[model samples]
Target chain A: NAGVTQTPKFRVLKTGQSMTLLCAQDMNHEYMYWYRQDPGMGLRLIHYSVGEGTTAKGEVPDGYNVSRLKKQNFLLGLESAAPSQTSVYFCASSPRGGVGQPQHFGDGTRLSIL
Target chain B: GESVGLHLPTLSVQEGDNSIINCAYSNSASDYFIWYKQESGKGPQFIIDIRSNMDKRQGQRVTVLLNKTVKHLSLQIAATQPGDSAVYFCAENGASGGSNYKLTFGKGTLLTVNP
Candidate 1:
């Protein structure tokens, strides 16, 4: 089974352009998260969803919005792409949010904003 | 904001040797810690994890050690091989008297295993 998958493995955008990144998981996880990774920087959470129809802000939620319309899908949207938004985007899901649950991640989407 | 940081940015080891990566966290109330390995063009993969109550945890070829008094954590790889070369990250999860379960990851340490 495909654990987690992200669409648009790579994308290039210009300033003020808008786009959405899609994340899907075959595992029936209850929690999903969006994170960004830059060179020499660790993964930073942008947004997360605990369940279907529920969303919450994470450490770096600015310049991004998320929607969890379905239990297996989480979408991250950039209203207006900026140069600073260029980074590798990752989607992760976990069966639960607790001490023992480890997050499973997708390959990642390399997004560059020019 | 609490932060997780690595002691060294890079490390090199020879095949058949042991490798150790260090990490330091600022949050004392953190209840859980995890170690992840990320290869080029891939996402981070979970290696091992330890809870605050436990000081050590071991996996197949990896071991995680936690020192709560110093807020320090370490990952040790046994019999390092070329395939073991990658970036390692340490993450912390804090419980602020609620159902908080957010992860704060460290910068990461690049491990190079030479044959």
Candidate 2:
């Protein structure tokens, strides 16, 4: 299984440019998340989806939007990229919700806004 | 806002020595905590987890200790190896409805195991 896979391992955008990062999980997990990792700052949640057709805001959802049109896919979009948004983005997925289920993560997408 | 923080930003240990990383969380309502290790240019990988009901949980050579009374958590690796070198993060699950199960991560501790 692919577990979790994120597209565009690297990207560079100018301020005000827009782009979308795609995350796909073959595990059929119910929970999927988007996080941004900045230097000296831990991974901050950007957005999340409990299941297909359901999306919710996370800790750092500003400057981003998400969609879960399909159970296996979660998309994070930057309407207008900013330098502050330049960071490594990670996608993760967890099986059915319980305290024991561990989250599996994708490699990551390194984004740089110029 | 919920916050999780690590006691140190970096740690160095000999290959055969035991390593311990400490974390402090501000959210008392957080019932679940997790430890993740992230290698360079990669995402965090789950190591171990503990619930508020339990004080300790062990997995392989890794152990997680939770002290709810003090809102502190720790990850211990016995007989650390060079492969253990990575950035470790401690995360706590919030209590809010929508974001209750969501994880809030600490800055992370860079563990460098010397051979």
Candidate 3:
């Protein structure tokens, strides 16, 4: 089974451009998250959803919006991409949001805003 | 703010040698800890995990040790091989209540195994 899949593995955009990153999972997980990874920095949470049709802000949610309309898909959107938004974006999911539950991650979408 | 950090940014070891990667977490309430291995161009894969109540846990060729007293965690790989080369990260469930599922990860340590 393909645990998690991220679409548009690589993309380049100009400043003020907009884009969406799609994350899909087949594991039927209850929790999904979006994060950004930068050089020399740890993955920072941008947004998350506890369940379908519900979303919440994370550590670094600015400039990003998320929607979980389906049980298996989570989408992250950049309304106005900036150079600083140029980073590798990762999507993850877990069966449940509880102790000892490990998150499964997708390969990631490499985005660059020039 | 509480955070997770690694002792070293990178580590190199000879093939067949044992390797140890260390991590430190500042949040005392973090009870669940996990280790992930990320190869180039791939997602982070779960290696192993341990809870605060337990001091050690092992799986396959890897072992995870958690020392709550010092807020330290470590991963031990036996007989390291070239395939073991990757960036290793330690993460903690720092959410105040149990099972929030959000984790704080360290910057990660790049481990290289030389033949």
Best lDDT among the predictions, by candidate number: 3
In model 3, which runs have C-alpha deviations exceeding 4 angstroms?
B1-8
Question: Interface RMSD, all models, one decimal each?
Answer: 1.8, 2.1, 1.8
Worst 10 residues of 1 chain A by lDDT: A37-46
Residue A72 CA displacement from its true place in model 1, Å: 0.6
Candidate 1's residue-wise lDDT over B1-115, tens digit each?
A: 1236433388899999999898889889889888888999998888898999999988998999999998889999999999999988888877766555678889888899999
If candidate 2 were superposed on the true structure by all CA atoms, what would the RMSD be?
2.4
Q: Which is the winner by TM-score between candidate 1 and candidate 3?
A: 3
Interface RMSD of 2: 2.1
Off by over 4 Å in 2: B1-3, B6-8
Expressed as tens digits, the lDDT of each residue in A1-114 for candidate 3 is 999999999999999999899999999999999999988789999999999999999999999999999999999999999999999999999998867789989999999999
Off by over 4 Å in 1: B1-3, B6-8
> Of the pair 1 and 3, which is ahead by DockQ?
3
Q: Give the per-residue lDDT of model 2 (tens digit) for B1-115.
A: 1136534378999999999998889888888889999999888888988888999999999998888898888999999999999988888877566556777788888899999
Model 2: lDDT to the true structure: 0.88
Error of 3 at A43 (Å): 0.4
Cα RMSD of all models vs. native, in order, equals 2.2, 2.4, 2.1
lDDT of candidate 3 over B1-115, digit per residue (tens): 1136433388999999999998889999887888999999988998998888899999999998888888888999999999999999989898687445889989888999999
User: Residue by residue across A54-93, what tens digits does model 1's lDDT show?
Assistant: 9999989999999999999999999999999999999999
Taken over the whole model, the C-alpha lDDT of each candidate is 0.90, 0.88, 0.90
Ranking by lDDT: 3, 1, 2
